[model samples]
Target chain A: MTKRQEHILQIVKDHGPITGEQIAERLHLTRATLRPDLSILTMSGYLDARPRVGYFYAGKQAGTVISERLHKMLVNDYKAVPIVVQENASVYDAIVTLFLEDVGTLYVVNQKGYLAGVVSRKDLLRASLGNKGLEGIPVSIIMTRMPNIVTCAPEESLFMAAKKLIDFQIDSLPVVRPAEEDSRQSELIGRVTKTTIARAFVELGSEPFL
Target chain B: MTKRQEHILQIVKDHGPITGEQIAERLHLTRATLRPDLSILTMSGYLDARPRVGYFYAGKQAGTVISERLHKMLVNDYKAVPIVVQENASVYDAIVTLFLEDVGTLYVVNQKGYLAGVVSRKDLLRASLGNKGLEGIPVSIIMTRMPNIVTCAPEESLFMAAKKLIDFQIDSLPVVRPAEEDSRQSELIGRVTKTTIARAFVELGSEPFL
Candidate 1:
């Protein structure tokens, strides 16, 4: 987010029910410029912006407001659309689907749509070269096992997901709900990849309207 | 990295002793088409090209081999040197430095050159609005504590540095020596930021060398 965006949040937090024009003036930006950001935060379920009225810090103000864009871009937005691949699919098929989708990784889920093991391009490629018949071998043979799988909570920020990819040196992250009290598998919610983070960063940094 | 680059790595990893002709035939690309990638990778230290023999992987393979151009572009190789502010400096001074440097953040270091904390553009802007006395307010009051700082290893991948920024929701990550068991503070090294990631991504995704 821009420095002006942070200042806007602070203003709304400190002085609620303030006009966009005032914030624009204070930040040396145009109301037209601020409108889109306000709309985005509102759409992401953070700040509440009202027409002819003003904006207010909403839903655990400290956590949301400005950085929600950062958070949403990380994991929440990716979780908004979950991608699934059957656990029994052949490794080659997974690779094909990956390339076709232009994604660096794919999620392997159980029949119930719960997350099983995760597979990535590197894993699949490595498996393909193995003497083992990859055409007959299920992705399970090469998949990154549960617990070894790095995941992100829906409420977590994009920064967190990006962190996982970087720290783990993996290309993608599976977005999953926390596992049930006693269950081994976490709910398969969605997926996020390095490209997702890169795209979001571009999106946020891009002055599309301007 | 592009799919072709990855394909080459996979080829080397799968059949290390294989020749360039074999890879070109395997990928169905003419040797001429692949020569540029080979030259680029070899020049960047990702691959060691033998005069008669084919290319072989070189150095430590870290997850993936992003091009040196991408590395230089994304890690802010040109502008990543950390900007230090003396420990006793006021938040106002930090603001002037940030503006002068055209950077999003600055580091706070003591007389002994040990890292104390960090002051970001957002922090300074927030402090600026708080009160007239902010000019006298020590940066330590507003800076994120040192022990809480996120960092990167020099040998780390660009993706790793990106993770620190995204995960912490902080604008900058100081690269540091891994802290010792008994110690709390890490030795300050270099710095990474959002702009670095964006620049690198753009370069990596762009055609031709950056």
Candidate 2:
């Protein structure tokens, strides 16, 4: 879509139930010239125009149209300090950390502060129920390894980060900086929880009314 | 803000790094007429204008400027089928339901399908660790009862529902239908989860790049 069309979508999203004449006036354009753009937006499902109420935003379609503001928001500003545990920590200790921190996932960091693995409450719960001793068992045995762990860059938008969480069905993501230009290792910086995106959405209030 | 001012904000938010001339052209207005609207939006913390890069969104303020789509989105369309259990059910049974459904919170319902209370994983965990017989203990003993439960109506906006969850620091909200105009009782129909809001935010993506 053209930049003008995207801008038009944002206008409808922010101030809807607006009339064509008003939209034209806001843009300083003739209603005749603005009509095509409005029609395109409506036909594309990004906007909806009422007979007398004017135009409003339609709900999302497959591969939703994300706004530029959200597309540019950096993860660093929104990420929370990650709750971490040593790789060798015992299951009992991890459970304590989980409750004390009130976090759904924990990052397992190596001695160098590089992300080693990840562990969830379900992992701890399952380990606790088995015959193995909670204090004796190291978290490494249950933690998901680095190769399988999902991580996000500090520069990525909340949109992409949130999509990763939804696509993978995970509750949180570790925000990291690449350790070297070519290395696979990364330095864990912060964490982005589902709550973070939810809070932002509440503040944004851009979704279509159902 | 005036409709014209809000529209100007949308323009800057979507096509930032765009010149004032470009904004004027898109809206079909003279740069002179658009100048005042731009100044007002920027001064109000809705838009940010750079000397070289044009304009951009200014992130959220105290009373977040919510989008019309979000203000219109009702809970009925987004709420999921509520995972519920009887208040009289055994604690052991409640745990089973929690795992089988894979939900963070459960709505405790009375005999008439009206919401009675709410139960969380922490509540069940604490109840199970004690000397009490899990099979004999009723959820009513541990669940948070009515009047204290946080809930939303199907007709309410997702914006309001999301605010409630954030304000209360809760993971989920039970969507209910009022039993009577004067009664406090409501029949639980669905649930709004953090995951749900997070996913919706990703789709919305109207927040500014911070």
Candidate 3:
């Protein structure tokens, strides 16, 4: 269901047997525009309406708005292409890639395009300041390898994926889908970054009501 | 403008000379529910309607959906209370505050509760690893002092404030309202953190669409 529908459901739950015009007024929408949403709710068994009595809440009250949707929003719906580098790429080249993409983290992919490792700005910064030349040194030497690198599947809920970012205190998570034949080997499909979430939040906040 | 009103404006732009019923059908709302939005748009000079000819688009195309709201969304509308400490507090206390709050950064305030400096996890980590006794050292000694601290006013836009966070590569920004008597001192009213933005985005993304 759309957020609007969920909101409408909440309104009906709070004030059952309310008129369409009243719901529209509360939401600053025309009764006409609210019809589709009203129809969906009634048809879905979440709402009940009578010929002259208006609409009434039919859904259970256990589900809150956020939880109702959080479990269903998959990673693939919003994940974006990630900036990646070969594990063999020099630390110097890794730094250049980081600047070019303007991303704090970079996913290191193997030659076959399989998820390999992850490198961050702090890793590069430490490498750059070291007396040792970074010209030919591979990122694999400093990158956080598999089993240590946190990842999420495309099928996973964005809510869980986002929680991982916070729990790990990382800026981004590589979205990987299982290989067609082998479930053990995951292919990097996209990325869910802090910026992506932040931009989404800003858009959400602009709404008159949640 | 609320997202719904924007949608109505967009619908009018894309399919002008459309009746209220048509708009209602397109949005699944009833005519009565959509009246207020239509009225607001018409009065705001964004839309034009005739006696029986239906609504027409009157706004320019260049001024699109986001920019119109971006410029007007004040920080005061979304800012939250900031995690802060006094400059005279020990580095040990600052470290405790950082872990206690589970925040990436901490705002250091003076005796009067004015923002004095900013301390980050990296700062605490470095201080803790040093041989010097953290109890003897004040947070002000290691914190990023004023003139170096990047901040935003409660009057600024979230878009502009968000840009600042990305441009500066920082995790949080202190939301300050300008002082009435002292131009040099700005009162820290709240904070705009990347996590705050992230949580918002996650909520936004969960919605089917605006």
Candidate 4:
């Protein structure tokens, strides 16, 4: 930590639960000089000042939370399970299947079963409304394709999964595993969800160390 | 919900905190017939039963977790804050800068302040060990560049951010806001990070709803 950062934190610790003006007054610095540091420190996870309020130390001391820990805790583990749909299945059949399956989204697969694209319930609804000739329409038309799929390996941690969810603004990740029978065959294994991450986080926060 | 699914959940709710066999018996189902459905339900976020014992409703049913909330969260409300290093700055200077700043990564920017690529602490560590001529090396050579930058709009919700993080498995999200003067001039405004999301989850779990 810089000498200035140390001073800033020390001031917060000693007279903390204190306001920014109070910090400036004690440190012999202007509020403007303190503002950038306060923003940086708070954003970096060192300071925990509420908006329009003064700063305070987020933890007993700073410098432990890493992007890696955040990734594991929030992502790699807590996602939804994925199911693939074959192209031969009719759109109506697919729709009924999904309703029976009760899933928000489904993956469209090629004959060899590689990921072609994804179909969300909304897409089906939109297609139905579009008069795109539902019976003649295939899911491939609306699906978001590969290089676009946000996927992960099963071995990665839950926090990694969470970071992707928050960073890219997606709902879930497809977990893929190489099929033993054929090296090129990748199977959709599981999904990590934001809700799962939230639940895990609750469990973790209640822990003493974490 | 399908009658089959309702039946399955009911059996678990009634006999469970009980075994899968009991659920099978109550539903007049073979253990084989119920296994796949049980697995699918558990994986899809509907049921949360433990293996070898029985299942329980383990997802947002206990509380409206982030995934449930994610359905309504948008993509434009967010801002991605990026960490940048000056062009002329040496690797040593950058290292000290990162350490003092308490940030895990930094983006190397050109003179115009447009993003170049990213440089992580790990990349610097690897650079340090090799005799790759550190002093004169501009931070640019090591960065992960433009097309590589996964960005989000100010309108995005924290859940959307979570999805990106999970999909890409990246550490930080550089939130961007459109420039007032030029529509093409998108600039860094805020950042959505793993720590930030973790803190949010912690905050969510602490709510009285749980």
Candidate 5:
């Protein structure tokens, strides 16, 4: 909208049901001059008019505004600190960390501090079954290794991260960046999970509806 | 908007940047008589107007329309069929069911088919650790018992269900209905999990933006 259009909108918003002639009077313009502006404003859904009652502000739709805001939300803004375990860590140790952190998934980093694998509760549970010596078994044996892991980048939209979680049917995503030493190796920076998506959904729902 | 207003909007949408005199002529009405309707249309964001260039349709914002539709989505519409296990089922048996159904959580029901408890992969994992005789222990022994379980109703908004998932820090919710035999007992009808919310989020994001 032009400066004059915005001004006209503000006037109608503040003192709406005011006629085109009255609006023109405030703007120091003729009613004929304001005709196009009024017509444009009404057409764009910024105002409402009634026969003999004049123009009034039509409130901005919350959905459009909120949707735009939502689309701009990035994974970097919402990702949680990732929980990591060494690839050599025992299945027992991974399970302990899982309970202590109360997280559904764990990232397995190799000796170089680059992501090597991802372990979920399901993996640990399946490994634990009928196993008397969980401590002896290396977590790497059960972890979903790199190349098979679904990951997200910090700059990606949270929506995209959420989509990854759904599409991959995984509980969490390692928010990663390329390792300084090896481009093929990922440095786990953070995490996006189903919980993150759920939290975002709640926040969206809780925003004051216009 | 009135029928005449809709008609005017359609006309402007189809042949916009057309003058008010032209629109009035098309409708068989004088320009003066159509002034209020045109003003209303412009103010309400249905059309845009430019001085000398004439009026044109201002497209509807997708966000608001999608948001309204999203808010109307109920759990009943998106809930998935629940996977359940009997209360007396062995923890070993529950583990088999969890893997077989490929579900993160399982609802436990009594012989009468009332919701008895909720079990999750975490719960099963915790029980499996350091235990060799998994079949000896009943799942009910480790399950999060009723009255402590957080649940959702079929009529609840998916947003509300998502809220509960985040707020309570749970993996899934048993979508329940009151049992016919006993009003106090809940009958498992469906399930809502983080996956469900993520799927919904993906769908919302996938919608074509206007």
Candidate 6:
């Protein structure tokens, strides 16, 4: 801002609800000279003006800013490293890997190292309920197979990933990129889970940002 | 915005890199009179000004806005109804309730209807791994007991609840209120889960808000 504008803002902030003529008097300028400044200030959300009340410092609106930042947050920057198991791995081994890695969902990869399926804790627990022992059963049999899995791209917005999680009523989404050898195959790179959204929400509310 | 201010904004947006003098001439206004408006517009992030070149519209910075809206969100507004089980209910019953309700966590309540413990999918999965049959064991034996469970108040900001979820590494928090008979006892009223955070994130990125 120019020195004069800064001086004008200070005056308004300190002695606000003050009239334009009064402000011009202090600055030794005509009200006409201050007209455009006052107009711009009010229009841009820096100050508020009223008929009888004159002008008052109208601070930034608290509920007015959210989507702009959310759109800029991409999945690549926030996705966590995916925990995966071989499609042939037993449900028992998949459960152990889930415990060892401390993740809610496990991506299943085929022998070709492309995404084959996804197994969540709910899926594992449901499988355990069966009379058949978990060790003998392959995760691929119980997992949500390829075409049914909800996946996201690294370039997608984190907001979109979060939306998919909510819409699908699932806990996580694999961040995948098309395989170089075959565009039809998906190679898992990372994951975006509800925990990721929660972490991002916490960061958005943290000190420097607040 | 005043009609004049809107007109000024449109001029800058359409004919940016046009000099202040050129703008003034087109609007049939004196350059000196337009100075304050230009200053205010630049300072408020509506326009970018270059020394020799002139002025250009500077669109809202996408990465600049987030925390304000997050702070406005309250747990009371976003919390989901708590899915709960009796403390003495068998672990097997709790698992059934979890699947029936499609929730990852369940609050365990005492006979008096006060919060006694909390159980998560992880907890149930671990219990299922034990040699002891889930049907024979009470959820109280496997749940995270009282005083150890992280909880939130209905009045707290959703952001704080989300922060607790991340900091404590928990899946969900029981939104509690003091029991009518005893202030020390917590009465479960609602829940805030990572799913809740994910849902809120999606809403923040939805249309109209954007």
Task: Give the alpha carbon lDDT tens digit for every residue of A51-156 in model 2.
Answer: 6657765543322223555676678888999999999998778878988888778999987778999998767655654234678889999999997999898989
TM-score for candidate 5, please give it.
0.73
Evaluate residue B163 in candidate 5 and report its C-alpha lDDT on the 0 to 100 scale.
Answer: 87
Q: Candidate 5 docking: what grade?
A: incorrect
- Looking at candidate 5, what is the lDDT of residue B35? 97
Better of 1 and 5 by TM-score: 5
User: Which segments of candidate 4 are over 4 A away from where they belong?
Assistant: A1-210, B1-66, B71-81
On lDDT, who's better, 3 or 5?
5
For each candidate, the DockQ is 0.01, 0.25, 0.09, 0.02, 0.21, 0.29
Q: lDDT tens digits, residues A1-210, model 3?
A: 899998998886666557899899999999999999998887655676655546765433212333444466678887989999998999878877877777778899888888889997666655554224677789999999996988998888777877788778888899987778677777989998887666544443344332
Share of the reference A-B contacts seen in candidate 4: 0.02
Cα lDDT tens digits for candidate 6, A1-210: 567776877887677656888889999999999998888776665565656546655543323446656777899999999999999999999999999999999999999999999999999998887445788899999999988999999999999899888888888999999999999999999999999999988887673422
lDDT of 4: 0.60
Off by over 4 Å in 5: A1-67, B1-69
For each candidate, the alpha-carbon lDDT, in order, equals 0.63, 0.77, 0.74, 0.60, 0.85, 0.83
Ranked by lDDT, the better of candidates 1 and 3 is 3
Candidate 5: tens digits of C-alpha lDDT, residues A35-92: 9988998876677676665776655543454455567889999999999999999999
What TM-score, computed on C-alpha atoms, does each candidate reach?
Answer: 0.36, 0.68, 0.51, 0.38, 0.73, 0.75
Residue-level lDDT of model 1, residues A44-129, one tens digit each, is 44356555546655434322222333434436755436556798998767766765665546788887778888776546544543
Docking class of 6: acceptable
Model 4, span A1-210: residue lDDT tens? 568877887876555546888888888999898888777767654556544435655442211222323334433345566666777665655565656665546777788776667775545544443253456667677777776877777877775565566666665577777767775656776766554564464454333322
Model number with the top TM-score? 6
lDDT of 5 by residue, B1-210 (tens): 789998998897666657899999999999999999999988766676766657766544434444455677799999999999999999999999999999999999999988999998988988888888889999999999999999999999998899899888898999999988888999899999999998888777665432
Q: Report residue A163 deviation for candidate 4 (angstroms).
A: 16
User: Taking chain A of candidate 4, what TM-score results?
Assistant: 0.58
